[model samples]
Target: MKVAGRCGEGSEGMVRVARGPRSAAMPHLVRGMHRVLLALTACGVVAFAGPARADELTGTLKKIHDDGVVVLGVREASIPFSYFDGKRTVGYSQAIAMQIVDEIRKTLGMTQLRVHEITVTSSNRTPMLLNNQIDLECGSTTHTVERENVAAFSDSFFQYAVRMITRKNSGITDFRDLAGKPVVTTAGTSDERLLRSLNTEKQLNMRIMSARDHQEAFSAMKDGRAVAFVMDEPIVYGFKATDPHPDDFIVTGTPLGYEVYACMFRKGDESFRALVNRVIVRSQTSGDAERLYRQWFTQPIPPRGINVNFPLSEQNRALFAHPNDHALD
Candidate 1:
């Protein structure tokens, strides 16, 4: 699983977590691999049931497949991943999506496979995939056990660690230090779930508030409605760069948990999921993953702010080395 190329180096070491919520025990990993194999076998056994005519689709993916197009659903808010690029959407995830679609067409021997962008809200993302409105979602989504029930996720292309963001003078040093203090997090996000679980399980006694989006959450921290905002480290760094007063905010707290950011598709569509996973593996093996990351995350911000090069943590490096090859069945 060793990838070729230098593979962007320069970060402190961190432990890699299982992308899916399974035991690190060898037996579980083996079982998971078996399940994926079985699922893919099932997909192979099924008849295509597609059109008799050349390049025509007769089933669920008719509109896009027949038209030789790949529809991607993305969040307009998530930065450094999928965000507005002028009138179009672009980012690391977007670049990965483009490569995936291109590979899909080539691998499947299709003459042309166009890419169509679809905007999706947090709540509608899963539903959109279930209904086949989007073939893939190339946004920053955490791969958690609950989410796995409805959708299949590709091997995580990126790793993120949870952290807290607050004003430099807020005096919040860690999760336990926020007793009775309000923290703003996006609604229906892993950040909200993690914080609430901490309060209950660890008896942290923190007051939590939810915002409709990341912008609102950050605004709450800036306006004093909330003492801090909780999210992954990279996300906080991305937003911190765009802050009107960059020195005003500070990122604090020990890493809570590791998150595996990956592309997602419907649970039952093994062929489609495998197609996306193949692209991810190729990207990592070819040094494209690290290159794309530097382009978006390390490069200088446009209009304002300085270049903030995010160092590659050891955990991510290991993920690139021994990725769960059976991410998609």
Candidate 2:
């Protein structure tokens, strides 16, 4: 996919390997034994004989076990989802990603595991995952059929409505009012695609402008370069809360689209995917997910003491009740 915006900067890309006293050669020894077992099985020497070894883990888990490290892709300013709080990355997604890391430690029976963090943008997150540059992407990424062709998503963790943020008196109350008005959307985001499609399908004659990121998109709206900033509802709220004049803008208009947010990783990794889905499902059923949602959405968070104040929607409550990876269109 072609991403239009400049990616976020200032990621620590921290590489943390758990310190341990285990023999340095243990990983190598395990790998050697794994190869020998595979060879024997392939040669039919052990076919249908003896207990089968657990299916060799592939993708993220395999890489983590081999290298003793896992990489997580994060966002720099996605706020409440994934963002930098001072020098540390903190948000709802960050917390969940750590939970997955803990599960990996248990699954591999490893006393220590390393973690590496990398910053990813809307355009680069999927490509980084596909290239194995990152084992998992924990950011504000929407899952769509087109993205599914290149990567797989975990169970939906959050849902959003695509909406518009404009000055309170802009007279843009709905999609019909957007005709012939300049609108800004972050580059490489679903909002951009939705606006383009609306323009084509409904002949709205909207003048679309792409911003490098949400901050830039909001700047355009503030400076009168664009009459409206179009993006996911949570994100719009995030920006509005942080703006100096929070009361100046309003998120209005009927939703142009609905989005399901989930963590993304490489395709064809069923073992890894299943592990991720299990973690999400367990969190949902145990009420851990709801707690995290409340922490970020209802309560005040760091850097700024602003609360997004978004109550969990009924659609999302249903998703948590019965977690599944299926996309909600």
Candidate 3:
């Protein structure tokens, strides 16, 4: 008698085995056993009959199930995207992350799920996610193809242009004017990458300085250590609105580039990524995301009563209309 066994890719592939003739009841027993084993494998309880591979069924969802906690990686001062509000973390991304947590709880059939918050800067956020130090990164992280190679990103929640913030009287109105000037950007950020590319391509001779985070970069600009601070336009607007002398600074120049902001997680986890995408899509289609956008962009936020007053751009509207995880060019 011969029986076919189904398997998945890799070691989990299906196989067929033949056995000598046996009692009529043997067929039923073999079939029953096969069904049970298949069920176990489907549940991620059993792998191929050998040493289990280390890469099997490990990701954000599995970790949440095992630990009963989901850690959120938040930024200290990415402004209305993610930021510290007094001792509490609050912002657009933070709010969206909480919604995801709620969905996770319901999906897992847990009455309560403990959430742990970890503050992450641009320099550490990616490594932290890769190391499983944080289950979800709810910050103003750009979704670039290079980054997507290492991490998974949800559909873009926000789109921003790369621009520079300089003193109004600095005579740096465009990217061309930045030649030979010292500019600061957050270390380990897309801003740094764009600036470097611009410097090399345009032969701008810009003196580039790296700050550990956005606040430090802004301070460098404030203290004259850097003639300009280059970052995402929304972030620049956030800092400018909160600055003591808002009129003293200006965000100028043609946009260097546009960035799509999305929540990040470790790669190779389709289930977890699908869950995150579902939540994001629902928010966009249900008007929930738009409400949050207005809450953060139009209304005043914490640390100070300041509003970025940024309306949703048409590009973002198109993104929400057809949510996708593809990196924008």
Candidate 4:
């Protein structure tokens, strides 16, 4: 039986089915097989039948066409990374997502692809990818060794160091310096994983609080419910800029670690992955990538409660300097 679901932007559309029939007369066994095939297709496991045609698209490309659009998962709350500019969306992540759509169109010999917006929080983004609910995620997601088990990452889109935000008097100087202090982070982010690992490996007594999203985590710290907020360096800077009492808080902590952010897909989609990589590469070479960054991160993100000046840290500069290659390590 045919099925339709609301993908990005709360829009109704049909998703790709590998073998489902348009009629309900199809047997349950066949439908089961169809689901399996769809899963395979979503992951790019099986190549489409017949000769590979430049005009014929499969996996994400086929889904994009069937839906008559591209569904991009993004966090409207994430500034610099992914967020809206009034009615229109703008950010480093959205810009890269658009580039990926262009590459998919070129690969399929199509002139256009529709863009659909999907709202996702930290907890559900990765799961959404595995279930085929999100064609591509434009939110800031870190690449980690353990996460690679289930998700395929595009070329490194951004990079930042993991740092801590605490009340100015809390006195946390560095990561290794936070021995027994409690730390807070959004649930399902690589920051949570990194903090936990450091706690164990360093043999330090650390209590960690998990928030459903970054906004929540920041609120906890602002309200003095938590001692510190741990996250990527850019996020910390953004928060500092918007805090009502910026001087009341201080962001300190040795670099616990570094992370590379990338767009995500279901694992095993080599063809789709390659297409995404090419798009970022093309954007970088064309100079559009730099322009997008300047437009988003450099601009004031008032309601987002954060603002970072143009040009990111020198440490994470390579993501902007070069493009198109995976930055997992």
Best-fitting candidate, measured by lDDT?
Answer: 3
lDDT of 3 by residue, 190-280 (tens): 8899999999999999999999999999999999999999999999999999898899999998998888999999878877886787688
Q: How does candidate 2 fare on TM-score?
A: 0.81
Off by over 4 Å in 4: 1-55, 84-88, 105-112, 301-306, 327-329
CA shift at 260, candidate 2, in angstroms? 0.4
- Candidate 2, residues 215-298, lDDT tens digits: the string is 788889989999999999998898888777889999998998898899998888877876787678768866788999999989
Per-residue alpha-carbon lDDT of model 4 for 1-329, expressed as tens digits?
33333333532322234453367787889967766665444333456622247455678767776777778898865666776657766667877887677667655656765677888888999888888888899678887778888888877777778888888887667776667766789899888888899889989787889988887888888887778899887777667766677788787877777778888887777778867775665455445666776666777653553557747556445565555345554
Tens-digit lDDT string for candidate 1 (1-329):
12122212431111122355656565977875655544433233224522234445333244455667778997775766787745678778888888887766654466566777899866678889888888789787778877888888888888878898898987888988888888888887787888898889988777889888777888898899999899878878777877767788888899788788888887766556656766776567556677787787888744353454577778777777665533221
TM-score per model over all chains: 0.78, 0.81, 0.82, 0.75
lDDT of each candidate versus the true structure: 0.72, 0.81, 0.83, 0.72
* Model 3 stretches with alpha carbons more than 4 Å out: 1-58
Judged by whole-model lDDT over C-alpha atoms, candidate 3 comes out at 0.83
- By descending TM-score, how would the candidates be arranged? 3, 2, 1, 4
User: Which candidate's TM-score is highest?
Assistant: 3
lDDT (Cα) of model 1:
0.72
Error of 3 at 36 (Å): 30
